[model samples]
Target: MAMSPEQPSAPRRSRIALWLVLLLLLALGGYAGWHQWRAREQAVVNSTQQQVDALSERLNAMRTEQRAQARRLQQADSLNRVLRDELDGITQRAALLETSVERLADPDRHGAQALRLDETEMLLTIGSQRLQIAGDLDGARRAYALAAGVLDGIDDPAYLSLRQTLLQERTALDALGADPRVRAIAQLDAYTQTVTAPAGREERARDERAPWWQRAFGNLLQVQPTDRAVAVQAADRAAALAGLQLEISLARAAAERRDTAGYRDALRRADTWLQRLAPDSAARTQQRAQLQALAALPLSLSVPTLGSTLQQLRQLRAR
Candidate 1:
């Protein structure tokens, strides 16, 4: 039997309703997908902002560190200037001391001992001033120690002893701190004993066998010279030694401060001095030995004062 038109139309309407429902569902799904995509995009933007902030902070930290390093370099330069000025003053004082010592040894100067004592006193005063200027407690203490030693060696009973017997006196004077008094006294006693004692057996034997007139001439020429060449050579040697001493002091200061450039410059100067002082092969070998000794020392050793520096320099030359 053939179906009625009404029945067929009803089936078609039901199919249309199903199609409408499917279309609605598809629209809802599209909206949900779009919302999810927008949320993901927002999350990506937030992450990017956080990364940018972190980079900016890192850049700022680097800049701050750079500025701090620059400041430290400037401080190092200032320290160098102070050191140079102190060294210049010390050099001047050393020259004066050398002249005084030379004069005191002269036979023509009858009151040479008294003059030497006075010169020693002056040197002590100058050393005190330099220590104050340097602003280094260790240096000041060393200078005071040296001064005390010189004072103790004075044979004159009137200046035999200091008013400040105890370490308290040094503290009151503000010349040297209290800690170095015992050490200074000990050093002074040792130095005095050595200076007053006679020559060693070897030295005495060498002196007895040595040519009298030639040796006398050499000794006299050191202070009272008739020959120009001998005097010139002696003067040149003294000058060179003085320069080497200065270089050694500078190197010591550089090492103490941990300034690589300053240390290198001082080392080069020391090497140059060694080269200049060594005229012959034997002397060169001797100088090389001295240089090696110095090189072997750690680069961080402290040199407190000019006197200490001079002592070290003498040790190097003796080697």
Candidate 2:
């Protein structure tokens, strides 16, 4: 059995071949396992990178939200400060106004003076209304004098000027003279007394001047020239007198209402009636002259400074 080294036995050769095949198989298996492990590691790294990107996007969004909330909070804090300052200013103003009111409030002496001023004002207003609207001169004068008395009673030195104003108003009122309506009424009364008197003498004189034949027929049928003034008929004499009286009454009413035009017109109408009633009488001429004079009288009292005292009083009270 000791064969040469070059020519080995058959079993030994077979065993050598099997050992080489096994070694080759073990090397191939080790390479395959290493390739699989590298592939797995690469997959794990890709997944980790994707997760990190997602986390970064979420954190940025959260940071942006936080910044916006902080800005809104700052704006809200500034607005609250401004509102608080305004409220404090308003409260201070209210307190100052209340203090000023408390310092100026007075109820005793101020109340009395205020009452006097009110009375004076009321009296002045009544006087003005009486003169302008009702044309009651006497009533207006009385009211003005009473207003003066009330104004004088006010002892406030600040209102000393008001006394002078009221006095001037009184002086102006006194200077207006007597009411023309009073004179007109007196004249009318005198005229009316004469109007009711008989026209017997005038009629007899006219009859005596007529022709004898005309006079004989005068009782039955009177005839006169058309150019001559027509006398009121005997049957209508009462009504004519009544119309004349009504005209005079109308004139009086117009004067009372301060209607200058209507007063003049009514007086003119009365004069016309007077002409009809007693055309040739001396009394008629005199009465007509009186009516003309009465018509010339102005019923309205125009004074630019009439209500100056009242205006001054009101201004003082306002102050």
Candidate 3:
């Protein structure tokens, strides 16, 4: 009935314990390997993120450097332009100085007689052109008188006839009157201010106030009166306005050139344009007086010519 020593049972329990310890060791090794793998993956991800951040910083620095370089290039271009302009100015000044030195070195430019003659001739030319173009009679007279005085100082018997011719031209310029085109423009401006209603427009406005039935009857029978004053068509009036303005400007130009006939033609064209645009004789009643006054002026006048005198002076100078 008493228990003896059981070695097999004890050995079986020891073997089972050994198996349990081996299983525990294997599970611990698996967990340690998984943790190390996860750590390596996280480290790789962090390294990649750091490399991307470094690349972005390098890109930003490159952009900033490029922008600064562009600014420097623009500034250099501006500075070069300024320097070029200054250099050009210096070159011009140098050229002008060289011209002055060259003139001083020439011996032929020292004579007072030649200088006076050239100056006088230039004055005569300016005067003749002024008289012919601008009708500046007074300015022409003064210039001719000055030229005659210069000729007198020359004390040359060869220019006697030239002096007499200049005197004659001076007398002719003294007789010239003011430009007549100025008065014409004044008259036109006055006429323009004299706009008036056409004859039948007022009567039509009164007739419009009648009863509706009466107006219908009048309109149907064509017995009651309405305005015969035709309104200016918008398109025609616009064209006429342009034409009138052009003609007026031409008239002014002709007057400035002392072309009496041309000025008259331009004025007449403007008048015709106005008539065509308005087409109401009664409306022109207000401007009739101004129109008559404008028409009364002579179309042409006896303007003195100095071509012969100028030619004779040039011939004398050549002699």
Please report, in order, the local distance difference test score of every candidate based on alpha carbons: 0.56, 0.79, 0.69
The predicted structure with the larger lDDT, 1 or 2, is 2
Per-residue lDDT of 144 in model 2:
94
| Regions of model 3 farther than 4 Å from truth | 1-20, 111-134, 147-319
Best of the candidates, lDDT: 2
Give the per-residue lDDT of model 2 (tens digit) for 1-319: 7875687889998999999998899899988889888888888899989999999999999999999999999999999999999999999999998865654475534656667788999999999998888777788899999998887787879888889888888888888777766766677667666655555455657668989987777668866667645464555555667778899889888877778899899989987777776656576777788779878987777656778988998897666
| Candidate 1 lowest-lDDT run of ten | 191-200
Q: Summing lDDT over every window of 10 consecutive residues in candidate 3, give the lowest-scoring window.
A: 194-203
> lDDT order of candidates, best first?
2, 3, 1
Residue 286 lDDT in model 2? 75
The list of candidate 1 runs beyond 4 A from truth reads: 1-11, 106-319
Assess every candidate by TM-score: 0.31, 0.56, 0.47
Distance from true location, Cα of 103 in model 3, Å = 1.9
Best candidate, TM-score-wise? 2
What does each candidate score in C-alpha RMSD? 26.3, 16.0, 13.1
